[model samples]
Target chain A: MMGQTAPMREAAKHAILILGALIVIIPFYVMVSYSLKSPREIESNTGGFFGAQAPMVDEYCVKVGNPKEDCLETPVIFNYSQAIKKAPLFRYLLNGVIVTASIFLLQVLIALPCAYALSKLRFWGREFVFSLVMFCLLIPVHAIALPIYIMLAKIGLTNTYASLVIPWTISVFGIFLMRQFFMTVPDDLIDAARMDGMSEFSIVWKVMLPTAIPALLAFAIFSVVAHWNDYFWPRIVITGDRDLYTPPLGLREFQGDADGSMWGPMMATATIIVTPLLVVFMLAQRRFIEGITLTGMK
Target chain B: MAVSSKNTGFWFVAPAVSLMFLLLIAPVLVAAFLSFTDYSLGNQGFSWVGLENYIKMFSRSTYSKMISASVTYVLLVVPLSIGLGLGAALLINSVRHFGDFYKTIYFLPVMAALLAMAIVWEFTLHPTIGLVNETLADGCGAWTETVFSFGWIPGIDGGQSWYSKGCQDSFPLWFGDKSYSMGTVAFIGIWQAFGFNMVLYLAGLTSVPRELYQAAEMDGAYRAWDRFRLVTWPMLGPTTVFVVTITTIRSFQVFDTVEAITHGGPSKSTYVMMYAIYEKGIQQNLMGIGSAITLVFLVFVLLLTLVQRYFVERKVHYA
Candidate 1:
C-alpha cells in the first residue's frame, strides 16, 4: 500500500509539472498558430488550440499587404520584406540599432571611468555622487519626460534623433551596474597596473576592460534590450516623422492606424518586430539572464 | 587610496555628467519652471501662473480618477506578479529534468518583445474570433452567451458576434468599456510581467539551503504547506521584499502595455497618471499642465517608494 501511494504521488507531481509547463507554452503556441493561419481561416476562427493547419507564409504575406505575391513556396519568405513595405521598418530598425548601439557605447565609455573612479580613485564627493546616481535610478523616466521635452524644444533639438539618443546616453542603471561589477574587480590588479606606470585611462582600457568583459557584455544586453524596447521616449521626441520612428514606435503607429481591428496583418507585423529581439535573446541568453539576475541581486 | 594629482578621472566623468546635465537635469529644471507657468508647446513663451496648473489638476474629477486607477493598477500588479513569480520559481526549482528548458520557456515572455506580445494579447483577448473566446466556448460551454441571453449579467452578450456589424452596440468590448478597462489592462500587465519576477524568485529560491528542508522533514513537518511555511517563506524574505519594491516601481511606470493595448482609451478609463501626463504634454502640448501632472506623479512615486522601503527593509532577513 505504501509503495502504491508513493508511485501515485510521483505521478501526481509529474502531472502538476506538465500542467505548469503547459501554461508557459500555450501562449507561444497561440502566437505561432495565429501567425501561420490564412486570413480567411483566422477570420473564420477555424484554427483551434494548436492550429488545425500547418504553418504557411502565404497568409503572412497577404496580411503584410502583399496580395499579388505568395511567399509560401520560397525556402525563406523574407517576411521582413512585407514588414518593410508596410512601414519604413528597415529605416526604423536602423535608427533603433544606431541609437541603442550609440547609447551602449557611450555608457561604456562614461561608466567605466566613473565606476573605476568610485572603486579606485579616492575623492571627496565620490560616495555622494555614487549615492546620487542610485537615487536617480529611483526617478522614473516618465517623471522627467515633461521637463526633458521642454529642454529639448528650447535647444531646437526636438524631433531630432539627438533628442532621443543624447538624453538617454548616460543611464543611472548602467552606471550602478558597472560600479557594482567594478567593486568586484580586485584592488591588487589596479595596484599592479599603477606599479607598471599605466595612466588611469590606460588601466581602465587595458587592465580593467578585458577583465570586465562578462560584466560589460551583461550590461550591453541590458542596455540594448531596454533601449531597443523603449517607446515612451521616442514617442515624445520623434513626433510627426515616420522616417525617425523606432521599431516600437513604428509598431505603435501600425496599431493606431489598424486600431485593434486588423489582427492578421498586425500579428505579422508584430512577428517581424519581435523576431530580432528573440534572435538576440536566444544568441545571448546566458548574458541576458545573468544581467537580469545580477541587477536583481543589487 | 590617496588622491593623485591626475585629473583623468574628472575628464572621464565630465563628458557623461555634462551630457546628463544638459539633457536630463536641465530639462527637469525647465519643466519645474514650466509647471509654475501657463506654458503650452505651441506658445512662444510662458506667463507665470503660480500653481494654477496644480490647482486645476486637483479640481478636476478626471485627474482624481486617473490617480485612483494608477494606484489600483500598481497595487494589484505588484503583489500579484511577485506571488506568481514565487510560485513559478518554486515549481521550476523542483524540476529534476530539463530544468534549463523550463527556465527558457518561462523566460520567453521576457525576451519575446513587449510590442509583439501586446499585439498578440490584444488579438487573443478580442471579443470575437479571439482564441480566448473559442477556448471559453469549448471548455466553459458557451457560458458567455448564456449569461448574456439569460440576463444574468448586464451589458455582456455571448451569442452575438463580437466583431460583426450590429454587434458593436450589443457585444461587450472588453478594452472599449470603461468599467472593465483597468481590470483588463491589469490582467495583461500581470501576464507580461510575471515571468521576470519568476526569474528573480527562482534565483532566490535556488540559493536557499536544502538542509533546512531536510531538517524540517526530520521534524515531521513534511507536508508541502508546512515545509513552505516553516522553511521557504522565512528564507525568502529578502527576495520577496526586493521583488515587491521593483514590481511596485515598474507597475507605476507602466507605459508600453497601456500604449500597445488601450492607448488610455474607451473614454480614458485606462488613463493612468503617466499616460495623462504624456497626452497633455506631448500630444496636447499643454506643457504646464503636463509638468504639473509629472510633478504630482513624481511625489506620489517617491512617497510610495519611501514607505515601501521603510516597511520592506524592516522585514528583510539577511540570512
Candidate 2:
C-alpha cells in the first residue's frame, strides 16, 4: 500500500508540475511559432509550430515598387528579415551588448575597490560609508528615475548613451554583493600580497579578483540580464534616438508600429531581443539561477 | 609609494561613495524637494506649489484610480506569486525525479525580457486570433465547457456561464476589457515572478536540516501535511519574509508590462505606480506631479521594507 501510494503521489506531483510548465512555456512557444509563420497565418492563427515553410510576399516590398516575384520569400525569412530591416534590430542588439557590457565593467571597476575597502581594509568613516550603502540599497533606482532624468536633462546628457549607463554605474547592490563575497577571503592572502610589495590597487585586481571569479561571474550575469532587459530608464532617456535603443526598447518600437498585420515581424523582433538571454540562461542555468537569486542572500 | 593602507582605503571607496551620493541619495533628495513645487524641464523659474499636487492626487478620481490600480496589482501579484513559488518549491523538493526540468521551465520567463513577453502576451490574449481564445473556442460544446461551466450540477444554468458566454460570443479581450485587464496583467506578473521566488524557496528548502523532519516523523507526524506543518513551514520562515518583501517591491515597480501592453489603459485598469511615474513625469513633463508620485512611491517602498525588517528581527529569523 505504501509503495502504491508513493508512486501515486509522485505521479500527481508530476502532473501538476507539467501543467505549470506548459503554461509557463506557452508564451515562448507562441513567440517562436509566430516568428516562423506568415502574416496571414499569424492573423488567422494557422500553421503549426515550425510553420508550413510556405512562400509569402513582402507586401511592403511590393508597395515600395519592387516586383512581386522579387518580394517573394519563405515566411521565416520574411519575418526575420523584416524584423532586422524595419527596425535597426542589429543596432539595438549591438547597443544592448555595449550598454550591458559597459555597465558591468564600470560596476566592477567601481565596486571591487569599494567592496574591498568595506570588507577588508579598515579606514575612517568606513562604517558610515557602509551604512550609506545599506540606506541606498533601499532606494530602488527605478523609484527615483524622474529626478535623475531631470538631472540628466539639466546636464544635457539625455538621449546620449551616457544617460543609459551613468545612473547604473553606482550599483550599491554590486558593492553589497562583492563585499559579502570578499568577507570570506583570508586576510593572509592580502597580507602576503602586501609583503610581496604589491600595491593595494594591484592586490584588488590581481589577488582578490581571481578568487572572487565565481561571485563576480554571478554578479556579471545578474547585471547584464537586468540592464539588457531594462526598458524604463532607456525609454525615459533615449527618447527620439533610434541609435541608442536597447533590445527591449527596440522591441517596443516594433510594438508601436505593429498593426494587426505586423505580428510576425514584431514577434520576430521579440524573439531576437529575448533569445540571447534565454540562450545564455540555458547554457549556464545553474549560474543564472544563482545570479538571479543573489538578492535572496540578504 | 609610502601611502598607508588605511588611507588607501578611502581612495578605493571614494569613487563609489561619491557616485552613490550623486546617483542615489541626491536624486531622492531632489525628488522630495521637487514634489513641493511646479517645476518643469525648460521653465525659467517656478513658484512653490505647496501640496497642490498632493491635493490633486488625493482628491482627483484619476490619481485615486492610479493608487487603487497599483495597490490592487501589488496585493494580487505578491501573495499569489509567492504562494505559487512556495508550492512549486515544495513539490519539486518532495519529488525524486525531473525536478530540475520543472525548475528550468519555470525560470524561463524570468530570463526572457518582460517587455517582449508582455507583447507576446498581448498577441496570445488577442480577441479573435489569440492562442488562449482559440484554444477555448476549440472547447465549445465539449466536456471542457460543460465541466468548466458547471453544467454537471443539476439546476445550474451552464448557458449563462462565462465559458458558455465565451463560446457563444467572442471571449473577452484579455487586455482590452477593463475587468480582465488587471487580472491578465497580474497573471503575467505572476508568471514572470513566481519562478524567481521558486528558486529562492528551493535554496531555502535545501538548507532545512534532515534531522528536523526525522524528528517530526519520530514524534508521530504520520501524515505529510502534519510533517509539513510541523517542520517545513516553520523552517521556511526567513525565506518567506524575504520572498514576500522582494516580491512586493517588484510588484510595485511593474512598469514593463503596463507600459508595453495596457498603457495603463482600458480606462487605467493597469495604471501601476511605476507606469504612473513614467507617464506623469517623463511623457507629459509634469515634473511637479510626477515628482509628487515618485515621493509617494518611495514612501510606500521604504515603509514596506521597514516593516519587513521589523518582522525579520521579531519573528522570522531562526538563526
Candidate 3:
C-alpha cells in the first residue's frame, strides 16, 4: 500500500508542477507567438505557434504611398522590422548594453579594491567601514529615488546617461559580496605576492583578481541582469531623452505609443528587449541562478 | 610593512567609502530632511513643515488608499510567492526525474525583464483579444465549464458559474477593472518573484542533511508528512525567515508592473508606494510628500531587516 501510494503521490506532484510550468510559460508563449503574428491574427487571436506566414500589407508603408507589392511582407519580417524601425529599438538595446556594462564595470572597479581592503588589510576604521556597508545595505536606493533624482536634476545630469548610471555605481551589496569572497582566499597567497615586491595595487589587480573571478562573474551577472531590467531609476532620470532610454524604458515608450494595431510590433519590441538576457541566462543557467541567488546570502 | 598595508587599505577603501556616502548615505539623509519641509526642486526657499507630510499621509484618503494598496500587494505577493516557491522546491526535490527541467522552466520568468514580462502579461490578460479569455471562451459549454462551474456539487448553480458567466458575456477586464487590477498586478509579482525564492529554497534544501529524514523516521515519524513536519519544516526555518523577509522587501519595491501595465490602475487600486512616490514627487514636483513616502518606506524596510537580523541571531541557527 505504501509503495503504491508513494508512486501515486509522486505522479500527483509532477502533474501539479506541470500545470504550474504551463501557467508560467503562457505569457512567454504569447509574447513570442504575438511577435510572429500579423496584426489581424493578433486581433482575432488566430494563428498557431509560428503564425501563418501569409504576407500582410504594411499600413504605414501604404500610408507613405508605397506600392502594394512593395508594402507586402511576411508577418515575422513585418513584425521584427517594424519593431526595429518604428522606434530606435536598436539604440535602446545599445543603451541597455552600455548602461548595464558600465554599471557592472564601475561597480567592480570601485568594489573590488574596497572589498580587498576590507577583507585582507589590517587597518583602522575597518570595522566602521564594514558596518557602514551593512547600514547602506538597508537603504534601498529605490526608496530614496526622489532625493537622488533631485540631486541629479540640480547637478544638471538628468536626461543624461550619467544620471542613469551614477546612482548605481556604488553597490554596497557588491562590495559585501566581494569582501566575503576575498575572505576565503588564503593569506599565504597575498603574502607570497607581497614577498615578490608586488605593490598592494598590483596584488589586488593581478593576484587577488585572478582568484576572485568566479565570485566576480556571479556579481557581474547579478549587476547586469538588474540594471538591464531596471525601469524605475531610468524612468526617474531619463525624462525627455529618448537616446538614453534603456530597454525597459524603451519598451514602456513603445507601449505608450501603441494603438490596438501596434500590439504585434510592441510585443516584438518586448521580445527584442527581453531576449538577450534570456539567451545569456539560457546559455549560463547555473551561473545566472547562482548570481541571482547570491543575494540570498545576505 | 604594516604601515604600508594600512596606508594601502585606506587608499583602496577611500573611493568606495566616499561614493557610498555621496550616493547611498547622502540621498537617505536628504530624503529624511526633505520629508520634514515643503521643498521642491528649483524652489529658492522652503518653510519647515514639521510632520505635515506625515500627518497628511496618515489622514488623507489618497494616502490611505496608497498605504492599503501597498499593504495589500505586499500581503498578497509575499505569502503566495513564498508558498508557491517552497512548494515547487519541495516537489522538485522529491521528484526522481526532470527536476532540473521544472526548475529551469520556473526560473525563466525571473530571468526575463519584469517590465517586458509585465507588458506581455498585459497582452495575455487583455479582456477581448487576450489568449487567456480566448482560451476560456473556447472552453465554454465544454468539460472545463462542467468541472469549473461546480455544478456537480448538487447545490451550486451551473449557469451562474464564473466560467459560464465569462463565456456568456465578456470576461473581466483584468487591468481595466478596478476590482481585479490589484489582484492582477500581484499575480504578475508572484509570477516574477516566486522563481527566485524557489532557487533560494532549493539551495536551502540541499544543505539539509539526508540523515535527518532517517533519524525522524526512526523516531516514529514514519509517514512522509510526519517526517517532513518534524524534519524538513524545522530545518527550513532559517530559509523560511530569509525568504519571507526578502520576498517582503521585493514585494514592497514592486514598481515595474504597476507602472508599466496598470499605471496605478483603473482607479487607484494598484497605486503602490513606489508609484505614489513617482507620481507625487517627480511628476507633480511635490518633493515633500514624495520624501515623506520615501522616509516611511525606508523606515519600514529598515525595521523589517532589523527584525530579520534579530530573528536570525536569536533563532533558526541550529548549528
Best by DockQ: 3
DockQ of 2: 0.78
Q: Which docking category, incorrect, acceptable, medium or high, applies to candidate 2?
A: medium
- Please give, as one word, the docking class of candidate 3: high
What tens digits encode model 3's per-residue C-alpha lDDT throughout B129-223? 89998888888888998999888989899889887888888789999999899999999999999999999999988989999888888889978
Clashing pairs in 3: none
Q: What does candidate 3's lDDT look like per residue over A1-298, in tens digits?
A: 7898888988999999999999999999999999999989998988798888899998989999999999999999988988998899889989998999899889999999999999999988999999999999888888889998988988899999899899999999999999999999999999998889999999999998999998888888888888888999998988897888898998898899899888888889989888888888888898888877775666
> Lowest summed-lDDT stretch of 10 residues in model 2 chain B?
B1-10
Worst 10 residues of 3 chain B by lDDT: B310-319
- Assess each model's interface with DockQ, reporting 2 decimals per model: 0.52, 0.78, 0.85
Model 3 TM-score, 2 decimals: 0.98
Tens digits of lDDT, candidate 2, A80-147: 88898899889999999999999999999999999999999888899999999999999999999999
Candidate 3 regions exceeding 4 Å error are none
Cα lDDT of all candidates, in order?
A: 0.74, 0.91, 0.91
- Ranking by DockQ, best first? 3, 2, 1
lDDT of 2 at B318: 61
